[model samples]
Target: MTTVADLAELVRAPAALSVPGDVVAGATAARALGPRTAALAGASVLLYWAGMAANDWADRRLDAVERPERPIPSGRVAPATAVGLAAGLTAAGLGLAAAAGGRRATAVALPLAAAIWGYDLTAKNTAAGPAVMAACRGLDVLLGATGGRVARAVPAALTVAAHTWTVTALSRREVTGADAALPLRTLAGTVLVAVAATASRQRDVTAALPVALAGWYVARYGGAQARVVAEPTAGRVRAAVGAGITGLPALQGALTARAGAGLLGLAVAAAAPLGRRLARKVSPT
Candidate 1:
């Protein structure tokens, strides 16, 4: 019988801490932050967990060779159970979106779900893997903007997507050690993402919080990637991936602050250290 721990590991429960900020950032940008925002963030978490479960299901065979200790490979969770959980979570996520934001949220969520499954089943090993994964996160941000001006959320979505692109690109090297070029390129991308997050036309005191959060994000995630550049081993690469996962809340908070939600952004940024602490136990990657 599969234990709760098995299920948690299968879905990467700790990593879901990075997901709600996507919704919060989007809603703040679109001026849609309200009661429904929490529900939509919940929906994003469900979809993210669904994607993680589906990823394990799809990679069960490969994982047997490369990751024998994984839930599916170790026989802690059956393949059927993982796929079923994935489908159920996907359905639940869409239903929650429909309930929270009606047709508008569902409309965006449908594509987001498709993108998630598409990335797991078909796109993960291809050259387009990072882009497809990034699209899922971008769409997730849009899902939270259904109640307001979605167009206003585009820059935030793109910023989140760009950061996700770097993470996903580096994730591909988790099992197989990469050359120095890979981490070097991703480190450069991380710097660009931080700059984009900090850039503001107003350039007043309002930008201070976002700038500080962006700096925090770069220091944590970029610092890990920098280590990988020095020694591109599988262990260092995995550590970098974990850092990217846990460091995402700072990026999200930066985007939220840039959208004029300073206190809420700070609240969102608080998840970073908590996520890092939890990751030590559960392994975010």
Candidate 2:
């Protein structure tokens, strides 16, 4: 159970997804489009931590309803402390981005901060929430690209955003508990659409495998969920997917950034074998 007493822990949601590996992979691939790959990855991961904290703070009350165990409502964290931490992290993330890309990175950071804060405070309950989430995803990509000095982040940013909507939707299935089937199907559809969009870039059968494998993962575990209790099954499914997302990005960065599509396939194949231990991008919970 996510609790309020543990607000410090809330920041890790976005952070985990950010560094989990696949994002690093995507960022690595995009790094060639810029100048400082490592800096961009660092800033991007920080941005993710800040974004999650900001969102959680904004939605703390709502979360208490669905996830009373989350640090805030559970009394594990002080609201003021959480707010300060979020602000500090947000500033740090932007500062890093600015250092790497100068004014251009700062420009990108403003909208990202606004979008992340806005999503948490108000937009999440509306139809616009999902778009806001996608925007953050796109911004993360942009931040990573800016670090690498790439001005042409539009295509990859859009590609990542489209898939982000799926993740957001999949996440929606889990509130007080996790939902199994619909989210999986939605994830499959989203991945396919993203892969279809990928055709605009990769233009090879190899590009298709990631989506196909993702779809297979969904289908394989989605139905089996009926056999187990909702909480545990959903948690397991989320864990696998989460671990895959976390690690594959790093592997993808290595392969795709280096122009090795073969390596991207290897990342997908290796996703399940890796550990899902989530590390903090900021204050560890």
Candidate 3:
């Protein structure tokens, strides 16, 4: 029988830590932070968990050969169970979005859910995989802005999408490993993402927090990618992907701070270390 721990692993529960920040950053940019923000964030987390479960279900065959210890292949969780959980979570996520932000949030969430399913079922192995995954994350950010001017959240959404692009690109190599050039290119992208996160029209003390958080994001994720550039082994590549997953909150926090929510951004950034710690046990990738 499947236990809660089996379901948690199937969903990569700890990795959900990186998700709430997307909503927070978008809400900050759109000036929509309020009680509803929490509900939207919760909705985002459910969608994220749905995606993870769907990914495992879709990859069950590949995982049997390459990663048999996974919940489905290992017999800890049945394939039907995984797929059922994914479907239920997806429905719950959409319902929650409708409740939290009415039709507006549901509009963004519908596409986000479709994109998540598409990436796992169809796009994950194609050349457009990274872009598809990135689009899902971008839409997630927009979901949080439904209560305010969504146009104001576009830049932050794009910034987070760029970061997701790099992470998705690296994730493709986590199992097969990659040539040094791939890590090199992703490292370059990470640097550009950090710069974009730190960009501001007014250079003042307000800029300091975002800059620091971005630096932290780059250091943690970039350092792992650098190691992959050195070896490009499957183990090293997996490590880099894991780093990208856990380090994402820092980038999200930086985007939130750049949008002028310093203290809340710091709270979001705090998730990075906690995610890293939990990753040791749960394996976020």
Candidate 4:
């Protein structure tokens, strides 16, 4: 029997916690917050977990050499089992989306699922890897906008996709050290994202919370990238990747706030620190 610990490792469970906020931010930005939002969030988590499992399954051979401690390579979980889990979770995610929001949500979910598989099986090692993964996240945000205001959610989708691009680009170097320029460039990108997020809101009572959350996101995530620039070791790169993954909720929260959902944004922002704390116990990257 595969233990829950093994399953958790196989699915990168801690990182899934970062996913729901993506849908929340997107839906809020689109002004589509409805009873369906909860179901869409659940679908997002399922799809994320499915992607993680598929990634491990596809990388099992390479991981056996370079990451023998991983669940599949270490024999804690079988490759077949991981594939099955990925397929099952993908199906569940689509079903949940269909059940919650009908055909429109299912349409988005279909492409999102295809992107997850494509990234894991085909595009993961290519130059297009980061871009494809970013698309998956962007589509995830769009999935929440199935309520028909997808055009209004484009900015939020782009914002989340940009953040994901930086993280995915850096994740490729988690094992091998990266060029100092890589993290430096990503740090610069992070700054621009912060500026954009904060600038969206005028100085007002509502603006304060979003601005503060965006500041916190940049401070923590950008600090890690800066450290990687100073020392482009594999360890520092890993740390930076971890921070990017866990700190994303704050960025999402800022966007949610800009969408005029300040209380919901604050709730979303609170997940960042909690995700960071959980990461100490289970690596997000």
TM-score of 3: 0.99
lDDT (10s digit) by residue, model 4, range 1-285? 789999998898988878998899889978899899999999999999999999999999999998899999999999899999999999999999999989999989999999999999999999999999999999998998888689888888888899999999999999999999999989988998887777663667877877888999999999999999999999999999999999999998998988899999989888998998888877787
* lDDT top scorer: 1
lDDT of 3 by residue, 1-285 (tens): 899998999999999999999999999999999999999999999999999999999999999999999999999999999999999999999999999999999899999999999999999999999999999999999999999999999998898898899989988888889999999999999999999988888588999999999999999999999999999999999999999989999999999999989999999999999999999889998
List pairs with backbone clashes in candidate 3: none
Q: Once superposed on the true structure, which residue ranges of model 4 sit more than 4 Å away at CA?
A: none
Name the candidate, 1 or 4, with the larger TM-score value: 1
- Estimate every model's Cα lDDT from 0 to 1: 0.95, 0.56, 0.95, 0.91
**Candidate no. 2 TM-score:** 0.70
The backbone clash count of each candidate, in order, is: 0, 34, 0, 0
Cα-based RMSD of candidate 1: 0.7
Off by over 4 Å in 2: 1-8, 13-35, 147-152, 176-185, 197-275, 279-285
* Worst 10-residue lDDT window, candidate 2: 276-285
Which runs in model 3 stand beyond 4 Å of their true positions?
none
Residue 244 C-alpha lDDT in model 4:
94
